[model samples]
Target: MNFINGPCGYFNMIVITSRSSSIPIVFRRQLSALTTLPLTLSQTNKNGQKHDPPSKINSPPPLGRLRASVVSPESTHFVDSYLTHSFFSDELKISAKNGFLSRGRQLHAHIVKLGYYNVLALQNQLLHVYVKCKVYYDACRLFDEMLVRNVVTWNTLICGAAHCGRSFKSNLNLGFCYFKRMLSEMVGPDCVTFTSLLHTCIELYDIEIGRQVHCFIMKFGLCRDCFVSSALVDLYAKFGLVGDARRIFDNILDRDLVSWNVMVYCYALNCLVRDAFGLFNLMRLEGIKEDDFTCTNLLNSAAIYGSCELGRQIHGLVIKLSFDLDVAVSSALVDMYAKNELIVDARKTFDGMLSRNVISWTTMIVGYGRVGDGKEAIKLIREMFRGDTGPDELTLASVLRSCGNSSSITEISQVHAYAMKDGFDAILSTANSLINAYSKSGNITMALDCFSSIANPDLVSWTSMIGAYAFNGLSIEGIELFERMLAYNMMPDPVAFLGVLSACSHGGLVYEGLHYFSLMTKIYHITPTIEHYTCLIDLLGRAGLLDEAFNLLTSMPVEPGPDVLGAFIGACKVHGNAGLAKWAAEKLFALEPSNPVNYTLMSNIYASEGCWLDVARIRKMMRDRCIYKVPGCSWTEIAGEVHTFVSSDKSHPRASEVYALSELLVRSMEEEDYVPNEDFTFDHV
Candidate 1:
């Protein structure tokens, strides 16, 4: 029998043919010399018969490298044994790389028989192989039994434990314990040790521990270590301490490409666009070429700053550097264009990408949703499903948002079913978005069901459910839900408070609205924003307190914005306070001169008060300014199709039928003594 040596170890005995009989002799001799095993090339086949080797077998070189030694026999023997162990280690690594765990175990057994099991270097190699195979338990067991250990041994286990992605808290403690033990053993932790520990802190967001590690590095005068310093920069930057990150970066005596890239990323993450660009320019001046990381970070900053001009420049640079093909850089570019309201450009970038991941798809969906293009966004969702990139929580949430904007109830229900089927209904973000969608679609019962489905609703969930109640005119229930939220020890954020205030305003609970407004600022320490003030003004105005609402608007710390002024004008029209109506209208017109609603509001108020001359003057001003009232439009969904009708519109395909039916209904109502209110009709001169 002839045996061929596999890459990892020697094969067992097999029959050798006459043509290949010579190769086994030399190969066996080399194996025997290396492993100290006697050569036996004969074996029985599975059928209990001897098998002959192939007729045309090629002879290969020896499996292991052996060095000549001029030392004593004992020294030469040790060198050869070490070289044999190294050969086995390399073979085991190759097995691990190929994911042949069974072959790796076999190689491990061979190393033990060669009397190198206790060798520190070989043990570390085995540990690495086990880690590569994701058999961390076995690696830990081996680590516990090793009588001899070195820094490399501990570093391997520490780094592996930190990156194993299992029982993070336990592994983190284990890694830290190993570091502490290394210190007690006087093994002297190196740059690799600190970098691993710092990374763990980064993942855990344990800033205090990371700070201590930074101090330790400084104490040991290892501050100049580029890798350690770069990790320190990352640690600080992640914690939002960009100043400290920059300080550490500046202190690095010898900065590498990683250090520069990290600092640039740090600046970008903090939204310091000018500083990031300045440092990037400095990096270029230093002759350091830009890579994908640099471009991605700069593009993210451009997105945050909403600078499409800067983003275009970066996009040009990306194409110049041929980095546009990089998925990460391309995703960043898509996000930048989407945020800047350049949806066409965003679509162009997304379409040009050769490959896209989940994030890339989600970004485009969100872009379309933001522009209220519900049809386009839903189409993309279907395309995503066809392409096998199933929608995740973010994708579903964005699609729900689009459905809400378009008031597409059918689409909302379909997406909600998909969420339940995909088990994403349990996620808080999806649940909140579902509540918002159902509420906007005028299905309060379904919205309530979605709210009740959450296992442990967070603040956002509470706020969304409360808003659903408020929006659907269930003000009492909305207030009760807010109280329930407080009873559960849930702190109300600005949005939650806004929901309750809106509920109070809608319910006409002036005292409750005023009380909560005070409580929000005094008890919760939440600062009132323009939305809150607008709600308050509307509440006062709705209760026939136009003067009080106007006074509140004037007393606001900040200048009354368009929404606030618009709310005040609406109150004037409601209460027939034409004097205050004119004042609010002037401000609204100045703020939004082209908005026809302001002119319409003023003309309606004058006509209501029988001021025909004032109404004519307002009409003339609108005509001179070329502003026309935007016709009021209402839509209804029938059989999953939306039918929209503008006031006095005659453009529908079945307009004559609709108008005839309307005329018939009105005549029937008049015959039944239904009196039409003529007070709201505008009289033309």
Candidate 2:
């Protein structure tokens, strides 16, 4: 190019500089061979996977006539070199976009062979490609070899290091190091630099560094930049500093959609539904259209706080904005309705979804399970399998829970089989749910097997195993496991304590139960819940320590709830204490006036005492109050089908046969001299 005398020759004219003192010159003869290296521009990858190229590059005119018509040969050479640089730059961008690391390396070699390695812009773009492809080693090497650099060069490396996949702590540290080096070189950071750094702080969960970034933004007078302001809002919100995030959000001069969405998300994330709604309204007032992120965050917040009314209002807005078609927004709607216990509404939303992802299917299944509709959950899973999106581990776990709630052993086993077949049984969450499901299904042996299969169980595994043992009546084993968990340095939470307390109550280990209760409160500092108190009272009541149980009930830190009083009443009935039984029954009746079980319990107590008058009065009170006993029901699985039987019911198609078999069994029992204990029989309520 005539020794850099042309218009754009200043780039080649500048002296080279680098991290090291000098750049070693390689012989042109040795490098010329690389220029002939064949470059493949095929759409197929080395692994035989086909992918579209990033974009098409425009071809330049042929050089044959161009060299002949040029005013001078040197000018033609300059134009030829410019075309080559442009071509290679576009190709490098394509490789970066598609993550074609091997192709990018080849292009780099070709660029060096063409003697354009010192072109600052070309070098910067190549660095970007390296960073984009996640080849940080090569990126750093090229950066160190570069004789000239700019802000883009540092920002590329910093942003890439900040956002690298896995092993992020070290990469984030490297990013911070790069930032320091950039400052040492007297290069001031721009808004993008601060934005990336703030994001990095959030990933590191270092609020101190986040605050320092915020200060730096202000110091650099870039705080008003919408990008920087939005980043600050996100950083503070992540650290739970809602006030700080709102402050930064309020100060934005030219607020964009991103800033508004960030502010709304901040409120939603902090569980401030009112603020989130208020900000959303303000956005509308400012003529800012709400997008999918805004709706998704608000709906999720409403779901978390159980604000069904607010969630519905948000749903209306979503429909008004025609965002119901968005998969994320629709999934949030389903989640909102399901968590609020409005299963019908949840189902309607789920059925109307135009496109459903794995999340949508999982949310609907979880909702059905939460509301005790195990069969519906199972049906939905089957439907999901029929569709494109298969159930994930969460879907399996939730459906397993539903089966457990309904006590459908057959369904539970079916789901477990599915999990095993699909490799979900090894997942920690699914495995834990399987343990609980088996325990509820009265298959303690299977539950133990599931627990044992976990190679490295987490806290949830231990808690689930302990609860399984406690629920299945293996109280001693549950207690031993709790101790073993503690010996392994697993700190017990409130749920773990509940499992151990339940074990103590079931085993009738009064002293041990009381000791563990004390340990939980004093050592673990866990506040006792109603379930904990119920277990303690039941333990004392089961052992006939009525006086002590009653005193504990009265002196409970929190008010004795229905469960506590009910436990005491059962204890009184067991020991034949008519006086105290009457007192507890009266308290329970007032607390749960509509509950037929409480009235029935009191009526049975009076009848057991031979107080016919009191029994008649109790029955009359029940009738006047329109109270009736809920039918007792049980179910069993036979040949992969479930059969349910309810007391005094003849609704089944085979009712006649079932009643006849029951009568024959009763006669057989009578012939064997079996005398049924009729303790306070219930004729009618």
Candidate 3:
């Protein structure tokens, strides 16, 4: 056998033999050649006898015989002694890197048997191996057993505790405990220690503790450390303190790539789009190469602002930089396009990804949902299951939202059943979406049932259930639910107030509506938005309090939006107040000049007041502007299929039959002395 040195001091041995040799002869020759090597002379056999070097054998044996002989106790001992101490440490590190925990443990035992376990350097190496293998308990045990500890040893254990993949809160607490213990023992922490603690704080979202760590870093004069500074930036950014993060980032005199990336991400996370882009430009100008992290952050910022143009530009840059194939970058791109309503581009990016995780799949499904393509979103869900990637809670929530938007009750029920079977129905977000889906589908009972099923509902659950009741005309139930939410110590957000206000409006509870509106602002400290004002105006108008509604609209602290004015105008038309309607319509026209609904509403009001000239003038204005009213349409679901009918529509496949049945029903009604109201007939128009 011939031995050759390999990388990292491991040996690579090769053996050659005559092709015609018998197995027995090859085995004998291999044993003879092994005995002649310098390594075998120091070997101790199982019987505690030493093997003498053979004199007669000079040639190497065949490979098979050599391998078999090396497994013997004496030969194994010989090889262990042949390796140097540094070489042995390297081998252990290789084993750890390969995730061979069993091999690492065996090597550790060998080190102990060789009486090298007391060596501080070797023990630290073993500790690192244990940490890398995620055998944190073993690492801690070894750490406790060490008679002498150094800064590296303490840092290793502390950092390992932080990254042990246990519950984040528990792991972070453990890390802090170890840190305090290190300090008590007079082991001053270095930059690495502070960096690890900052990371733990980031994960725990304990900004107070993070601030303490920051103060310590500054006291120790370690604030200039690039890695430590970047971690601080990340910590504050995650806590939504972007201004503080920027201050730290700006103080870094020797900023590294990580510092630049983190500051850009901080700005992006806080939705400071212009600032993020500005920092990105500055980074490029400073000649820092942008990585996948940079592109992902910028793409996410673009998604928030719905800036498709900026997103497309970034997409081009991503492709130019060859980052389009990266999973994180690609996922962000898909999300950006989806949020901007560019479903086609989003799908294209999704399909082009070489690999897909749950996030990528969820992003595409959400994009389809946002565009009101519920069918496509559900199709992706099935495809995801078939591909062996089971949908998670987020995936289910997004699909539920899509179904709600499209009013696809059948799909929603299917998804709900799947969620129940898969045990995701109990997840808070998924359950909240279920309430929304049921409510948007007009299934108020199911919405309430879902709400009741929640053992401890969150604010979203209460808001969604309340909205369902309000939208379905169960204003009393909605109002009661709001009170129940308050009783549970859950403060109502603007959305919750909106639901209750809408409910009061629909139920003709004008005083209740006004009271909630005031309560939302004064007690809850939530400023009333245009949506709230619209609800209040609609409530008063429905109750024939048009003047009060108008006064409230005009007295809004902020300028009323088109929705508020439109609601007021709608109220005037409902009460047949031509002067108020004309005044509100002029405001609506100025705000939304191209809206055909406003023109039609004004015309209807004038016609109801027998003002033919004003009605003709409004019609002429609509024609001159080429504005046309959207045809009123309604749909009904039957046998899991939706059938739609538009006003004066004769294009249905069964239109003639439907018309004949309608005529027969009218004739029968006349025979029964049924009186028909003619106020809304074409003759009035």
2 or 3: which has the higher TM-score?
A: 2
Give the CA lDDT, 0 to 100, for residue 433 in model 1: 97
Regions more than 4 Å wrong, model 3: 1-213, 235-247, 270-275, 518-526, 616-632, 661-685
- Local distance difference test values of all predictions, in order: 0.81, 0.82, 0.80
Off by over 4 Å in 1: 1-214, 231-245, 582-603, 610-632, 665-685
Looking at model 3, residue 649 earns an lDDT score of 83
lDDT of 2 by residue, 1-685 (tens): 1132222334463222223423212233333222211122323333334343355346633333223333432222122343455566667778878988887777777667556778777788888888888888899999999988889889999998878854458888778899999999999898878888987887788999888878888999998889899999999998889999989988999999999999988988888988888888999999998898899988988988899999999899999989999999999999999999999999999999989999999999999988888889989988888888878898899899999988888888888899999999999999999999999988999999999999888889999999998888899999999999999999899999999999989889999999999999998898999899999999999999999998898898898878888889888888899898888888887888888777788888888888989988888778777546677778887776667888777998889999999999999999999988776355455
lDDT of 3 by residue, 24-97 (tens): 11132233232222333333334334344444233333323333443443443233223334444666677767
Model 3 — which ten-residue stretch has the worst lDDT? 21-30
Residue pairs whose backbone atoms clash in candidate 3:
1-60
Looking at model 1, the pairs that clash are 1-14, 1-15, 1-16, 2-14, 2-15, 2-16
- TM-scores for candidates 1 onward, in order: 0.71, 0.74, 0.72
Better of 2 and 3 by lDDT: 2
